[model samples]
Target: MIEIKNLKKVYAGVTVVNVPHLEIKSGESIGLVGNNGAGKTTLFRMILDLIRPESGEVLSNGKNVSGAEEWKNYTASYLDEGFLIDYLTPEEYLYFIGGLHGRNKPQVDEYLASLTEFFNGEILKKGKYIRDLSKGNQCKVGVGACLLQRPQLLMLDEPFANIDPSTQFRLKNILKTENKNLGVTTIVSSHDLNHVTDVCERILLMEKGVIIKDIATSSSTLSELEEYFGVGQTTSTNTGIDNEENH
Candidate 1:
């Protein structure tokens, strides 16, 4: 479980993230939606203790995450390409991450073998470094490494961005399976509304650093979000894609 209490962040006199209270129960698949600068990544950073909030706190299983190390044992996140070691090959990167979590080479190999379809035969046995892979392929490597940890809490930002259509389909299945079978607390932020709605059981919409709407995933959820974003209108706003730079 995760809890946010009066969380706040500021930069150069402007508040980026502010939340009075929020709770994420275990085994929940949540989709965080917002235009760029809506504070999606800022909130995520606070959750992982990557950035210190100006006030309040984020708790993982009742333990404060800020300025603490214990939560790292059960948490994993992939915010961007910076999370990857650019010089290593995909195989090397996965092995290194698995090793950090006590999975030996044989164990890592076994796990990698199971992802052959996800890899699409391009990620493994390729002699190229991660930096050399296309952006979509690199995303695959990074996301794969995160799942290798089997973390209790998993977070991914803009996971569908730059990914091919086929791989995006595969990723949806992978995330749903992991959340359903392993009960991982999965939090994802995405600009792709359809994909996010397909995978997440709940949705949180943010604007100007605050959550304006929080709703369960239902038959009308996608259309509701589309209406809010003005999907078919000429004067459409934000679209949840333009605000990418702010996060």
Candidate 2:
């Protein structure tokens, strides 16, 4: 479980995010929705210990996230494109990430084998540096690497940005299966309400760095989420294809 207490972030004398108390239970999938500059990414970074919060603490499984080496083994996160190692091929990148989590090459290869269909034989053996792959393919490779580790907590930011529609659907199913079957807790932030509604059991709406609404998926719909964001008219009905995959 993750417990965030009085979390706050400030940059250049400006407050970005402030959450007094937020707790995410193990194996739960939670979605965060907010407009640009609403500090959604900042919050995710704090949880991952990529950035320091101005105040408060984030604890996972009874250990503090900041400067906690043991917690590193249990948490896996991908915040943006920069997180990928541009010099490595997709297979190499997967192997490197799995190795960091104490998995061998054979284990990485076996995990990649299961995801072969999703890659269409284009990623695993392509022998191209990750920087050379298209953005969509890079997103797929990053997400695939994270899954190979099988961490207990996964945090993703804008995870559907550059993927094709078909792949997005596949990713949704993959996330659901991992969360349900493996009992992995996930926190995903996306502007695509439909994707969040389809996968996450809870949704937190942010406005100007504050959570304006928190609703359970069982009690809310994408349409209602659109209304809450005041973008109902612009909400995509394009069959879940209009998002950037940042997992």
Candidate 3:
């Protein structure tokens, strides 16, 4: 559903993102993993058209994302709390997003009801603006907004970073259900290795703004990744591992 070609982004003479070619098929659950300054979020921003690439293009359903508004109709992304309307309460923020998606009040309420377990009783009826909530609660609000859209393509950055363990597991199940049952194309970047591995069937390891590894997760995928990160590593060792068996 998404294709990237010759994508590159430079900052102050440093090349932060340089993806030559990448394609993500519909209903694919993808996990992007990398250390800090790896440019994972930069790549995501470009895909969402929040940042224009210095070269190349991002295509959604065969249309360049930068040139078309159609992709926004089916795409939902939440990278940070900046995506939220901080002045609005959680319910208000969600309702606004639902309205944009053509969902009425009743439909949004029903959907919010379904997220009781995921919210763990901290999100709704809090009586506080989104900016007043704690970091984890703010993240919950952002994720709730994304899910409310029932998007065809969902992208989240570091979604597992702020929430508690129980909420993390809940989110993993939600993502899996969205991909396997609803056929939503899910792309999530996370610092937690276990969370990403459990939810995604494919994993991309990035370094120095390059996709050095494209691994199809297997029974031993977690261990393989752990091993890769365990030892002090550098991009020079495995510059670009395109296939799964290399792991």
Candidate 4:
């Protein structure tokens, strides 16, 4: 389980994110949605301990994330290109990350074999560095590496941005299977509403650095969410009218 308490982040004298309390239980898949600069990425970073929050605490299973090295072993995250080792080949990178999680080479190979088709033969035998791979291929390698350990907590930001539609569908199914089979708690952020609605059990709506709405997918539909985002429901009403005219 992950618990966030009074989390806050600021940059250049402007507050970027502030959440009083949020908790995610184990075996749940969550979707975070917001316009650009809505602080979704910042919130994920804080949870991953990649960036420090100005105030508040992020706890994993009751341990403070910042001080919990054990928690790192259980958490796997992929955000952007920065998370990948540009200098290493995909195979080497996967082995390295697996080693960090205390898995041996045989264990890594076993995990890779399970994701055989997802790699499309590009990641396993390619001798080229990850930086040399195409953006889509690089994303595949990053995602594959993150899943190698079958982590307890998985967080991905814009996981489908660069992939083709087929691969996107494959990934969505893979995530769903992992969540159900392994009981991995997952959090995903994406602009694709259909993808989010299909995979997440709970959805969080953000606007200008604050969480304005939290709805269960079981109780709400994506069309209703589109309406919330389309009109003056949470933020400014006139902005919705302007958007409608522009459309």
Clashes of each: 1, 8, 0, 0
Off by over 4 Å in 2: 231-247
The candidates, ranked best first by lDDT, are: 3, 1, 4, 2
Model 1: pairs clashing at backbone N, Cα or C within 3 Å: 36-243
lDDT of 3 by residue, 1-247 (tens): 9999999998777787899999999999999998777788889989999889899999999999999999999999988888999999999999999999999999999999999999999989979999999888888888889999889999999888889999998999999999999999999998789989999999999887899899998999898888888874854333232211121
Give Cα distance to truth, residue 173, candidate 1, Å.
Answer: 0.6
C-alpha RMSD for every candidate = 2.7, 4.8, 5.2, 4.8
Against the true structure, candidate 1 has what lDDT?
0.88
For model 2 the local lDDT of residue 48 reads 82
Query: Taking the tens digit of each residue's C-alpha lDDT, what string does model 1 give over 1-247?
Result: 9999999888778777889999999999999988777789888888988889999999888889966687898888898888999999998999999999999999999998888888898899889999999988899998999989989889999989978898899999999998999999999999788999999999999877799888999999999999988864243244343243443
lDDT of each model, Cα atoms only? 0.88, 0.81, 0.89, 0.84
User: For candidate 3, which ten residues in a row score worst on lDDT?
Assistant: 238-247
Candidates 1 and 2 compared: the better one by TM-score is 1
Error of 3 at 129 (Å): 0.5
Candidate 4 displacement at residue 156 in angstroms: 0.4
Taking the tens digit of each residue's C-alpha lDDT, what string does model 2 give over 124-200? 76679999998888888878877887889888887787788888898899889989999999999998888999999
